[model samples]
Target: MTVLLTGCSQGHSPFIPMLGAYFPYWMLCTFIGLLGAFCLRVLLIYWGIDDKLPVPLLFYFAIMLSISLTISLLYFTY
Candidate 1:
């Protein structure tokens, strides 16, 4: 028996062409999310509020994902 898998064809590329290279949109969104998370962490630390969180690591991860998804939707969606 042989099986063939077909992927969705949306007739549009999922990458952003920059300069001479193509970059994945998700990766760019992820990077932006990470940068935003880092800046938030710094601000929280400076304000002496970082330690107040019950679960810092989970909170940070959630924040990054939320930011990433928001960016992707805003930029990629019609």
Candidate 2:
């Protein structure tokens, strides 16, 4: 029973090989998320709705989190 519990976790953490170093998976997701947020912001501005947001900073932050979390969940489930 102890072994079963202990061995449930995978041997390796999620990592991506970049050149010679292993980059944490979440960083890549974060960069992608930031890009997504920026694109959304551009679209909002183009639509003339960016200034109408009640709290633009929080809204953008939430957008970033949603993008990153979706990537992490869909591709790297443990």
Candidate that scores best on lDDT:
2
* Model 1 lDDT tens row, 1-78: 122322223445687887899897899999999999999999999999999999999999999999999999999864
lDDT of each candidate versus the true structure: 0.86, 0.91
**The 10-residue segment with the lowest total lDDT in model 2:** 4-13
Residue 20 error, candidate 1, Å: 1.2
Candidate 1 yields a Cα-based lDDT of 0.86
Model 2 C-alpha lDDT per residue in residues 8-74, reported as the tens digit of each score: 3556557878889989899999999999999999999999999999999999999999999999999
Which residue ranges in model 2 land beyond 4 Å of their true spot?
1-11
Error of 2 at 52 (Å): 0.4
Backbone collisions counted per model: 0, 0
Alpha-carbon TM-score of each model against the true structure = 0.83, 0.82
